[model samples]
Target: MNETIIRPNPSIVYMIFQLKTNQPSSKLIYSIGPNGVFPDTQGMLQQHSDAISTVIDYSQGETSEVSYLKLRRSHGVINMTSWSILMIMGYIIARHFKKWDPIWFYLHASIQTISFVAGTAGILIGYALSKKVDANVNNHKNIAIIILVLGILQVFAIILRPKPESKLRKYWNWYHHYIGRILIIFAIANTIYGLSLAKEGSKWFLAYGISIAILVIITIILEVRMWIVARRKTQSTNNSSHPQSLEFAYQT
Candidate 1:
């Protein structure tokens, strides 16, 4: 049987075929031109056919290209979903559930932990996939590394968090919040890049886009409501502070 392999960039094409029925040797014929077509050379073909070839045995447990592609797709899904939950839902819980106090903290921590684990698993899978394919996706790889590092730092910061009344608590909070925001930004960008590379279609992009939009809307509404409540409390406190006005109103 013969196999044709197409390299993505530079568009090189290779055709591999067995030389003899009794031998395990194979020969490779490659072409470098547009649309897998190039000038045919009888001398080159004869030379390759006469030379010895190395047989690649696949009877053992070797992963096929198709399986590698499937694994890559799965990795992309895991990473994208994990980061989305970590950034969107986690932020929502932290921001809107301030009244819940320690409970909100626990909930946020649990969600973040789960997402981090999933994201880490996905990154590992991606590393393996890239190795298998010998890919040179520098942008995607660099962004993923940054995100993982930020995640690890965030986790460690939580572990060593100071008490609420401690002087270092404010600095810790600033570090955690800013790092998380930057991580989320990079993660989202990397996810979009992965989606484009996979060519998974428009539906996936639409789904994520809608999810982010809804989260933004909810955040805006909650922030406005919190501001209004704070303003009302301030007005009430100011009115209570003016005892002379209160006594004059009573006399009238």
Candidate 2:
């Protein structure tokens, strides 16, 4: 067995620390070098003044929440995955797969529900980051709050949806459609705003922009094709019915 002790130099002062100010076990010790900076590469240092002498380095990595930057990134990625990618895909399926009928409707509902859940998770992460850093993200935070509210409205809209035969169904449709679009718009914008503030880089921002553009183009083409198919069906049905009406009149 062996022991070595390094007592704090009482004359040393003006040391700064980061992360945890103290390791939760005991008192703190600090050191300053000739440049008035902490000798550690992080430019800060923390030491327990009363720590027991130990030759074994048994300290563990952080067991608390993940790093600040990782949390920020997760927030962006989650919301983008849910609202921008999955939610838009749901809209496309419903719009272009009209012949799928109840199946398409079910798929649409299921996907949007999952999207809301993921977006909600992202919202929680964003809130945590806000409290952790507490700076310069007002625009992103405000937009997120709006999106969350809209998400709740959409959820209630589904729950309170009118029956197909109900007189108010058309108005419900209008409300649901418009609000969903607005929520998607805000979610996408907030994601971009977050990317801009992110310290990592611009690659994610570029990728997301390209993806949303592709979705928009696909939506346009599908919308046009849907209308064309609907018009053809209506004309075919009209033409097929006239001969039966003429035949009945002649028999009478």
lDDT tens digits by residue: candidate 1, 23-124:
553333232334434446642232121112232444662432223558888898899888764666787788789899899989898888888999999999
Residue-pair clash count for candidate 1: 0
Off by over 4 Å in 1: 1-65, 244-252
The positional error of residue 180 in candidate 2, measured at the CA in angstroms, is 0.3
Give the TM-score of each candidate. Answer: 0.73, 0.68
lDDT of 2 by residue, 1-252 (tens): 033344556864342334343345332222223433343666453431211111222275322322466677788889999977898998888778878888999999999999999999998888887776544577888998899898899999999998999999999989988888898889888888788777557689788988999999999998898789889999999999999999999999
Top TM-score: which candidate number? Answer: 1
Global local distance difference test of model 1: 0.76
Go through the candidates in order and give each one's C-alpha lDDT.
0.76, 0.76
Runs off by more than 4 Å, candidate 2 = 1-67, 234-252
Clashes of each: 0, 0
In terms of TM-score, how similar is model 1 to the real structure? 0.73
